[model samples]
Target: MNIEIVDIVNKINVILVEEFEVDEDVIEAGKNLKDTLDLDSLDYVDLVVIIESNFGVKLVESDFANVITFQDFYNLIERKILAKQQ
Candidate 1:
């Protein structure tokens, strides 16, 4: 179940770019995800659905409370992916 951070980042970048129509340039590690993606509440649901489908990790609302930057989001995904392996 070992996964690279680069793989997580690449998958997320593609998901954001293709599913949310977010600009690829804005999807950086230190940038704010919500602000960069301009995601509304419904958009969050869509994001969750896409993430679940893509990563096979079921995400809850609280999972996003501390996810401000793309790095945080990537870390969360990594955690979830690893958690699922357990």
Candidate 2:
């Protein structure tokens, strides 16, 4: 499936808001996930599960090392989804 970045962002925002109890308004594309969302290691684990369950994309530790911002998260999911298609 060809997913748009905006859709990915929206889905991610919903997950964050519902799962993490994050405010929707704070979820911007450029914001850093750790700094902006105050996500810790456990939160990351939950996020990985959520992504895998929701998007059918498995993310490893290395995939998250460089993913600091929301856009990076979106790109990671987008890449994984596209890779799954191929």
Candidate 3:
């Protein structure tokens, strides 16, 4: 169940575009995730749900405490995916 970062990126991009109605161009690694996506509290819930369903990685609220950038979010997902594999 090894997952590559590119796979994570592609899935995340698709999820953001389809589920969150985010513009693809704005979904950059360097951007601030919440601000770039215009996400509110409720949107975080939806994001959690989508991430769980898409990657089988259940993310808790505290997992986002240090997640400021989209790259940080991707790294979190990658770590969770690797943890799940273990």
| Cα TM-score of candidate 2 | 0.94
lDDT of 3 by residue, 1-86 (tens): 78899999999999999999888999999999999999999999999999998898889999999999999999999999999888
Model 2 misses residue 27 by how many Å?
A: 0.9
Model 1 lDDT per residue over 1-86, tens place: 67888998999899899988777988889999898899899999999999999899999999999999999999999999999889
Clashing pairs in 1: none
RMSD of model 3, in Å?
A: 0.6
Write down the worst ten-residue block by lDDT for model 2. Answer: 1-10
lDDT of 2: 0.90
What are the lDDT scores of the predictions, listed in order? 0.92, 0.90, 0.94
Give the Å error, residue 68, model 3: 0.5
As a TM-score, model 3 comes out at 0.97
Per-residue lDDT of model 2, residues 3-86, tens digit only: 887898889889999999989999887888899889888988998999899999889999988988899989999989889989
Model 1: ten consecutive residues of lowest lDDT: 19-28
Question: For model 2, what is the alpha-carbon lDDT of residue 39?
Answer: 81
Residue pairs in clash, model 3: none
Error of 3 at 8 (Å): 0.2
